[model samples]
Target: MKPSLLILIHLNDASRASIEAAFDVVYAPDSTRRSAAIAARGDTIRAVLTNGTTGLTAAEIDRMPQLELISALGAGYENLAVDHARSRGIVLVNGAGTNDHCVADHAFALLLAIVRDVPQLDRATRDGIWRDTLPMQPNVSGKRLGIVGLGNIGEKVARRGAGFDMDIAYHNRKPREGSALRYFDSVVALARWSDFLVVATPGGAGTHHLIGKPVFEALGPNGFVVNVSRGSVLDTAALAQALVTQTIAGAALDVYESEPHPPEALLTLRNVVLTPHVGGRSPEAITASVDNFLANATRHFAGKAVLTPI
Candidate 1:
């Protein structure tokens, strides 16, 4: 018999079909259904498919006594109860590198959208306004780009910035060994020195509101900020205030603190651009992430080492 797998996130038909071939899936993408599934089939469930945001709790893990593996479909696993799962001897795996390119691409898309005033300009043009009447936006080339985290995604963002002739610098917990880009000891310092600040840090308590009023102030009135990482990394209230007061030139975000719904504070602002948290989403990315999960789960069940153990 196929192992029972509890799915805790939405999946496209293609992904569902492929996964269905290998396991008996309980397609519970919400709270009520998830709880019911665990209650009804807990003993038979041997695996779980979830993302970082839609995490499997210690209590939930406890309910699934038969669960031997848990897999996060994407790179971010900020909310996952990793330690507890490890304690239960359940193998944990994530698709860390699967969506790096997609995220980097989305980050640049946000940066360019804000820096070039693409959305506003498009609207103005539609309104029959000419360049002569509209305010001039700054060039994206030859700018100083500051990246908050220099991980795999950040490095890819740097590579994209380089193509635009940008002078790239980054702030990490410590200097990344053998990295050629300038390293900043602090996020504020990096923001102060940059024409654009792109946040790519991880989520969780350690980085919650890491980009706040101080960092926004340091970026000055002409600088722009882009967040392609987790929403908790930036203070949405502070960002909205910055836009209202023109504390910064403009801002763009792929994620915000109040997610699944547009931030009420920045909804009416003309200087801000927002996209649903889709930085790591693409057909290619989805396929790669699904394949990564299948590989890890298959190996674990086959009595082999999981490929991307968390």
Candidate 2:
């Protein structure tokens, strides 16, 4: 018999069909349903499928004492209870590179939108305010772009920046040895040199609030910032203050610290553009993520090391 699995995220028709075909699937009704369902069939569940933000708790894992593996449907597994799962001898995996391009695309999209003042322009056009009434926005071409954490998504963002003839410089935990791209040893240094700063780092204790007052201050009054990475990477309160005081020119973000709900301060700002944490989401990206999940799960049960271990 196929191993029983619990799916937490909302899936489309195609995803649901694929998951059901491979596992004895169970649906989590909601957060409440999760505890109830786990309690009822704790010993029966062999695996749990979830996303980074909608993580499976240690308590949830405890309820299913028989669980051998946990899977993150996307790249970000920030909220996953990794220590507990690791202690229990359960393999944890994420779909890291599966959605890199999608997220990279979104990062540039946000960058362009905010820098070019697309939203304000659209609103102005709708309100019958002609282009002449608006101040001219800067051109994206031939600008300096500084990227934080040049991993898979960061590299993709750099590639896109190259297409725009923008000079690319990056800062990571360590210099990406032997790489040809210009390297900045600090976030403040990177922000100082960049006309646009794009953040694509992984989030955890190590990166929490990596971009804060100092970085924003370095960005100065003419620089723009875009965060396609996690929200905690930037200080939301400081960012809001920066926008309000014009410390930075403008900002765009696809993720926020409050998650499903954005910070109350950001809603009142016109200099910032926000999205509901959908940087790596697309039909293609979602489908690829599920495929990675299935592949990792299958390999784990088959006694092989999983791909993209978190």
Candidate 3:
């Protein structure tokens, strides 16, 4: 018999089939089961397949007395009850490096859309206005690009910037050795020097609101900002205020504080672009994420070390 595992989030049919082939996959009670789901199969589950945001809580973990493994399908385990999992001797793993390219692509898309004023241009053209009346858009190529958090996704963004002949510099918690890219010691310094600032840091207490008023002021009037990382990495309120006051030229975001709903402040801003945090939703990224989770789970049950442990 295959090992039994509990899944907390909905998955594509193909991904579900893959899980079924490897484990006796059991889903949470119902799409709308609420507290009753935890009450139902809590004891029977030996492992859980979930994402970072829809994490299994401590209470849920307590109900699942047999659970030993907790897996996050994405890099974020922000909301996961990590301390409780660590205390219970549960093996915690996350799917890192699974969607680097997808995220980088989305980041670039947002930057281009905002800097080039794609939405406004489209509206103007539809209103019978021609390009001659519109002002020239800023050139994205050959500019100074600042990357926050030089992780896998940040590196990918830097590579893309290089392809465009743009100079790339990064700021991280510690300077990385053996990299040819220029490094900035602080986020404020990077923002001060950059034409475009891209945020690719992880989401958690350590990084919450890392980009706020000070960084925004540093970005200056001609600078642009793009955030493809977690929403908490940049302060939403500050961003809106900066956009309104023209503290920055323009800004684009794929993630926000409120899930499924955007902040009311950003909705009225013409210089801002927003996406529903779908940066890592491409087919390739999703496949890699599921494969990463499965491989980690297999290695874990086999008593080998799990990949990308938190």
Candidate 4:
């Protein structure tokens, strides 16, 4: 019999089928079902699949005494109990590069959607409003673009910015090796220097609420902010206040403090654009991520070193 594998995130039929071929999957995409699966099949489960957002907890890990590997289908593992898992000798891996391009594509999409006022313009056009009544929006070209993280997705966002002839700079804990993009040691400083700010940083305690009132203030009244990273990185209360006061020109977000539910405070605001967290989601991205997971899991079960261990 195949090794029992517990899955804590939702997967489409094809993806599930692919994994089912390799392991006995307990599909539990919700808390109730997850707990039930853990209680029922904890003894037999030897591997688990989850994403950054739907992390497996230390307690859950403890329940799965047989679990030897935990795989995140996407690049992020922010919510995963990394130290705890490491202490238990559980092998951990994430699909780091699998969805970078899709996320980068969505980041630019959000940036342009808000910068060009696409959604509002579409509404106005449908309501018989004309160009004479709309406020003039600035060009995306010839602007300084600031990235909050200089990782793979951030680099891709910068490359897209370059296509529009925008100057690109980034902020990380430290400057990335061999990167020529201007680096700021602080997020507030980067925001002040940028015409557009795009956040793609990691989530978790280190980055939670990193983009709050101070960073918003630095962006100034004419600047725009875009976030395609984790929602926890941006504070909803601060963002709502900033939008109401016009502290920043406008903002676009693919992810925000609230997930699964829309941010209530931002709902009534016209200057902000929001998307459900679909930044790193695409058919191509999903396939690549699952394929990466399967390869890593296969290597581990075969007693070889897994690729892309976190």
Model 4: ten consecutive residues of lowest lDDT: 251-260
- The prediction achieving the highest TM-score against the true structure is 4
lDDT of 3: 0.89
Q: Work out the TM-score per prediction.
A: 0.98, 0.97, 0.95, 0.99
Report each candidate's C-alpha RMSD, comma-separated, in the order given.
Answer: 0.9, 1.2, 1.7, 0.7
**Per-residue lDDT of candidate 1, residues 21-77 (tens digit):** 998999999899998999999988999999978888899999988989999999888
Q: Write the per-residue lDDT of candidate 4 for residues 258-284, one digit (tens) a residue.
A: 688999999999999999999999999
| Rank by TM-score (best first) | 4, 1, 2, 3
Better of 2 and 4 by lDDT: 4
Error of 3 at 251 (Å): 0.9
Residue-level lDDT of model 2, residues 1-310, one tens digit each, is 9999988888888998998998998888478877777878778999999988888888888888789999999888888899999999999999989999999999999999999999999999999999888999999999999999899999999999999999999999889976789999999999999999999999878999999999999999999999988988999999999999999999999988998788788898888899888898899999999999999999998999999898
Model 3, 1-310: lDDT tens digits are 7888888877889989999999987776244653565677678778888886677788878888888999988888988899998999999999898988999999999989999999999999999999999989899999999999999999999999998899999999988787789999999999999999999998889999999999999999999999988888889899989999999999999988776588788998999999998998888999999999999999989999998898
Pairs with backbone N, CA or C atoms under 3 Å apart (clashes), candidate 4: none
Model 2 residue runs over 4 Å out of place are none
Give the candidates in order of lDDT, highest first. 4, 1, 2, 3
Q: In candidate 3, residue 282 scores what lDDT?
A: 89
Error of 1 at 69 (Å): 0.8
Whose TM-score is higher: candidate 3's or candidate 4's? 4
Distance from true position, residue 96, model 3, in Å? 1.1
**Candidate 4: which stretches are off by over 4 Å?**
none
